[model samples]
Target: MAIHRSDSGRAPDTRELAKLARSARQGDTEAFLELIESLKGALYRTARTILRNDEDCADALQDTIVGAYQAIRSLREPAHVQTWLYRILINACNTILQKRQRQSLPGTLPEPAADSPVYQDVELREAIDRLEEPLRLVVVLVYLEDMRIADAAAILGISEGAAKMRLKRSKAQLRSWLAPADMGRERSS
Candidate 1:
């Protein structure tokens, strides 16, 4: 299914994306380039949310684009391009994370640069980074990427209800973490 955003104007039209996907699947290189161009920002933002490092984000995006282009012909529905593309991206990011885990000796890698625009609010970014992968992914996909829960579920390979539940739990967790102790005591009194 084509992902419909609440703020439709921010994203390219679903019909146009599908048409591009169809042509790309038929081995039209220009169409594939256009499709990837249109989704590049969203793809980068999603990757940034997961990886937090610009270098890793770029690597993941490159890998995802190459992987998607190779597998386009196998995609059963053009309308599902966004979902399929994100699924590939998430997998690519995970692959990078796995490699990083194996290669790094705990403190070898530098901390995420605070100056990055994507991490404007350090506290919020740290809180998000602290979330478990599944919950963090749901939050990033639905909230950060402006994706519908159904679409997020499609990418995550989860039921819509499960995606919704994850989002709910993430919000609660974020709130508790962000909330002031004084605020909680005030509310109780």
Candidate 2:
């Protein structure tokens, strides 16, 4: 279901979202489903960015949904439902990563998801894949997801200043990786 965007086209009304959350907390299944439906795109992007594979992304999303439903009553701020959902998603992704780390060979990474919708550009995808977790997550939240630094920081449980620093560092790293090709193009031209 398409969320109803306001005239500004920013996000769905926070008041509406908060109402859904409050209803969901009170055992309204339809409201809970609606809330999840609205956030499905973002949840997928977040999981795909962190896990880098469809299977793990699916797992993380499932875990997040279940966890969020079970703990909906614990949510302190109804208006911050998006942030709360993202926090649960991030934790689910991290848990999957930790498990994968334990099972994988030393120094090896998980295979990239085939035909990933988000990272269609091969070069950019590889560069983002090479970034460390913190920087990579910041890039995903701030750049790919187009979230504010403060919002990204809240999801990542970091200070706003730290989120800004990570965004800067991620940009510099991406530029370093992508600049060589640009330089080659310029030289050829």
Candidate 3:
């Protein structure tokens, strides 16, 4: 059975997830360790989005593990584990941000996701970095990670309407920043 089944796969194996979540809750360290693999990429992407530094993303990931471990027992369902994990990750990122703010460091571009050509563009990454925190986060969760808007809103602890509003605003901002020449091309076409 696939670990992180995507939207189009046959129904996910709930029994496998239940066993994993149960083991993790029962102090099985290895099961807990294995469960993290499904989330590592998305976690890295979101952390990178928020911190824009590889080291900071690593720190945030570490914090996320610790926080998730401490709180996993409270989680009520295995099916929503990824969403629950994302909420923990966002908290960890916020903690790292607080530390960075106190130290007064300039943000830098993180290594982009290796799987996507779109992430390869330095200018696009720079444009994303210029967005406000809420808008940037919405873009990362929705556009970059291909998560549902509802999932993004849940992970961000916001209403769905609020998430939609941020996405709408961010789209306008990104259009202005990344595609100035497209306007002329559109008219000509």
Candidate 4:
């Protein structure tokens, strides 16, 4: 399937989503699997960016897929499936964060696999992890995932202005976090 760019001018096409939603709502297992296949990478990346741990990210993605499948019938607008799935993923991440916060183990969490390319640049990843959850979510969805600001706002349950504001702040924070000597290398080069 060809991927059409989103409004942000980077994301892929969401046009086929309506058919996937219809089949999923009808309890078509193959269709549901197709839906998952289309979204799983983005969902996992979003979760990983937010949670910063492989186990938590995997758990969040799993929960999101299950929740999406179960809740497909309640979705009124089939064309908005991408946003709907993102919302579920964000919710699942938030739930996991809240649980981690309550357990007081947030900071102690370890990074994911060293072999993964995502871990290649430790300083950048560390900088991203230091951001507040809200800003981090916005950065991941918009910059990394290439989602449009309006669609991200919808998925994040925030106003468009709020999404833009968050994106600005996230960029500023990333800049600030990278200001230290070693960390500054990435941006300068």
Candidate 5:
């Protein structure tokens, strides 16, 4: 059930997605619900990586879902529904982060037990949380969501070079955060 990068390098069926988007845009509630169900896990994971709080992530996702419903009509390219949803998710997470900042909330928080593996995976999750937002988003989109660099760049509304730069930084940060002690534990099992 791990959501890691796909090695096969095949693109998803954009035609079918476009049809769904068109239907949803035309006020088809079931189509919209189906779209949400298809993307919920990835959306939640992306929000969790950015917001780093279960409650905030959930709130952000809820906001994103609502926003998407309202904004779907404005979407020019139905074929790009996935990227469109990702853009909304990022915006939602950013909004939550800004609100939390105004309230002086901590930036990074631990994942819930249900969302993480046992004690052995705690260090790995901590390493991921240690990343800055830019790097973390790239990691989540590229690795966790199995998006290619070009596609991830499109989703994040950044240049491919920027995406690559962020990925490089994220990997380096993760390696540094893992270090010897953390790596030992992760590798021992």
Candidate 6:
């Protein structure tokens, strides 16, 4: 026999998630575990967008899980749990990125902008990797994750207007980078 969960290619029910959040906040381990399972795939993608390394993604995820478990009780609004968890994951990913920057010697070569395993468009991913963290993050959350603007902003801990502005900036950058004439100039200069 096979069991299908709401995670089987369907959006989870908000009410069900709210109830789970409430239970998790009340110190129910199983509920929190369930919540994590349902959200892990999206969370991992978000981490990948920032860190670009599987090992770093793993570390960020581990940190996020621990951090969330410890702080669940303080999540005041159960309905906002998904974005809350996302925020924690983003913070963890950023922490790992900062540590990597500090550990690397100044003369060491930067890692290549890898072709994203998750997206078929190699050039797009490369362009995205070239973008600053704020713009790249908004693109990944809003476009790659298929998340709404407001929710993406919430997860980024920014106002919705700021998220929109970053998204616009990213689009302009991608357009400029991908243009044929711009590419020639970029290669030459």
- Candidate 2's residue-wise lDDT over 113-135, tens digit each? 56555676888988898899899
**Model 1 C-alpha lDDT per residue in residues 81-121, reported as the tens digit of each score:** 98889999999999999998888896686556344444568
Tens-digit lDDT track of model 6 for 39-158: 787788888878878889899999999999999999999998888989999899989988999899989876665565557788877888889989989998888777789999999889
Q: Which whole-number lDDT from 0 to 100 does residue 104 have in model 3?
A: 75
Model 4 vs. true fold: TM: 0.79
For 112-138, candidate 3 gives per-residue lDDT tens digits of 533333376777887887898899999
Candidate 6 regions exceeding 4 Å error are 1-11, 113-115, 182-189
Question: Considering TM-score, which of the candidate structures 2 and 6 is the better prediction for this target?
Answer: 2
Name model 2 segments beyond 4 Å from true: 1-11, 107-109, 180-189
> What's model 3's lDDT at 30?
76
Every candidate's lDDT: 0.85, 0.85, 0.79, 0.79, 0.77, 0.84
Residue 158 local lDDT, model 1? 95
Give the per-residue Cα lDDT of candidate 6 at 53: 81
lDDT, candidate 1, at 37: 85
TM-score of each: 0.84, 0.85, 0.79, 0.79, 0.79, 0.84
Using TM-score as the measure, the top candidate is: 2
Model 1: residue 120 alpha-carbon error in angstroms: 5.9
The number of residue pairs in model 2 that clash at the backbone is 0
Model 6 lDDT, full chain set: 0.84
- Which portions of model 3 show Cα errors greater than 4 Å? 1-19, 105-118, 185-189
Error of 1 at 110 (Å): 6.9
Task: List, residue by residue over 1-189, the lDDT tens digit for candidate 5.
Answer: 112223453334566667788988898887778777767777878887777678898899999999999998888888889899999888888888778778785775545424542114777776776777788788878886678899899988899999999999888888877778667689878
Clashing pairs in 6: none
